[model samples]
Target: MLSILDRYILKKYLGTFSLLLLLFIPIGITVHLAEKIDKILENEVPMTEVLIYLYNFTIYFANLLFPLFLFLSVIWFTSKLANNTEVVAFLSSGVSYYRFLRPYIIGATIVCAAALVFSMYLAPKASKGFNEFAFKYFNKGRSDRDQSNVYTQINDNDYIYVSYFNVTEKIGSNFTLEHFEGNKMTYKIAAGQIKFNDKDSTYTLFNYSKRKIGETNDILKTQHKLDTVFAFSMEDLTPVTYIAETLNFTELNDFIKKEKARGSSYINRYEVVRYKRWSLPVSAYILTVIAVAVSSVKRRGGMGVNLAIGISIGMVFIFFDKIFGTMAEQSSFSPFIATWFPNFVFGILAIYLLRNAKR
Candidate 1:
């Protein structure tokens, strides 16, 4: 059903991409191991855990740079074809530039689908393992979540606050919970300290006191210690900064919905993660078009010139992505725009370059 030219280019596209992954992933692992080996040894981390961490780190690293790798692979192989005059011969024949682009589009489709799967499921699992191991070993005494002055609305009528929370221990100090009926406060509970029991899904509050507000007077009750159930979990106090990254597509959607209801300060951060899952994969098509257009013309500067140009473009794209992503996370910038802006700008570039290549 396919022509020989299509098959040949498609084979080259996928093979080169695979080769780049194999080449770079090891270097990434080696660098990461070199940096963390001292901490790993000092912590006495198990060899099995270290191996698993590396496995997770591979997926995490690959997912983070998938688009760049794909972009470079397309440039590398297409530049080679241009250097050999194969692309020139095909275009000089009866084949149109669009016809020549067909295999690249097919290759982009394959990569896009695979990338979607990775972002939706595999990458989240790897992120959870990778970040958990880092926090447990490499970042001891430091937390990956906001741990001070945490406030959350558990429901329409219930709100909770904690002065300080310990994520590792699932404990909080200066905890308070308030219940409201319409505009009036119904009751409030305060605790000197609180600990969550994971086994029983309960909470232990030390030096607990409850105040029930009335029209005339307030009734107060006190206890040295109390074990009670609350509608909220320990995560409600202060979820990790990367919690959104560790959830799969379905879970992320659900989490965003809940966080929205709770008026979370990190909503933009979560939304950025959500939008990137789709945007990153879609960039494959735009980058592929740009790569082919950049490399299909034979130049005196040769493949090196094409690669240099490609790497520069790749670095710029990554720069735009990281800057905008950080702005969205740290400020009130629109996450949708931040996530898609790089792709949109480069898509325009792809079109312009593609027109020139056709000419």
Candidate 2:
């Protein structure tokens, strides 16, 4: 079930979306680097380290820029269609507005799906390495790399605890493992110091002692060397304790669950980012509908007017998204809604305006 007009619109949809994202992401990175170049130079950062940090910043900025770039792409591309009278011609040729918009919807769906995959899977995986490089490369002070009270739970019933972990050195002290049986503690092992072996995905506890308070409260103690496998490896910790932007949706979800169960409040940022990663992808679809609805009306000022309004509205959406995200950290507003409220509200408004424009 397809038509020539559907194909035309699909071409425009994908062509514009891809072109804008490609163009704007580099522009964004350039602007970001230029602004920070002085600071980097003044700080006496090495050229290699500076470039690595810039790369990390650029990647994270690109992820955030996708929504705005997509919005602008739709607006400008559709304005061209309206300007050339192709839209009017389509209507005259018996193409209903919704029917004409179908290809756009399909294209938006593809973009949305791709966005989800990148944000939830690939991007996060990249972020892990990027963040580590950023920290290790640009750290001005040796003490800047220390981590505090790093605790994580690997499974529903199994837990891994590190009282004070040093991320810069990959060392943890006062480590403990407490196994649970529904609501009761069944096993407890306390270690003196833990070291992570990145190659084998295991933790080596040195000069450690343990006490097993279960089954009969039979206390067991040891010192010297203890080796064990941790549910999370060194790279996993980099995402949680170090950088919020580095984790994908699944990683964020698992991190929040772990920290929350461990009675840690520092995970609110990760929780918000988790919901945001899921919600941001559909923004492309919303922007497409809004762009078509706004531009097809043939305003008095033509394309320039439409572009200005489009950019303004897009900026407002970004502002609102940031505001709600901040409020999510400080208030009781549901983190899920806080991250996604702008997209949800704007999507509904776009539907209403699309109907009005057709009338």
Best by lDDT: 1
Superposition TM-score, candidate 1 onto the true structure: 0.93
Candidate 2 whole-model C-alpha lDDT, 0 to 1: 0.76
Q: TM-score of the candidate numbered 2?
A: 0.72
Which 10-residue span in candidate 1 carries the lowest summed lDDT? 232-241
What lDDT tens digits, residue by residue, belong to model 1 across residues 1-359? 77999999999999999999999999999999999999999999999999999999999989989999999999999999999999989988999999999999999999999999999999999999999999999999989889999988899888899999987788899999999998888999999999999999999999999999989999999999999999987778887889999999999999999989887888999999999999999999999999999999898999999999999999999999999999999999999999999999999999999999999
Off by over 4 Å in 2: 42-55, 133-244
In candidate 2, what are the lDDT values of residues 1-359, reduced to their tens digit? 76778778888878988887678767877886787667667777778876766666666666777888778888888888888888899888988888878888888888889888878876775566666654454444543332666565656776666677776668878777778889987667777888888788788988776666667656778879978876666644433454566666666677677667755545666678788787888888888899889987677788999999999889999998999999887777778889889988998889898999898
Candidate 1 whole-model C-alpha lDDT, 0 to 1: 0.95
TM-score of each: 0.93, 0.72
Positional deviation of 278 in candidate 2, in angstroms?
1.4
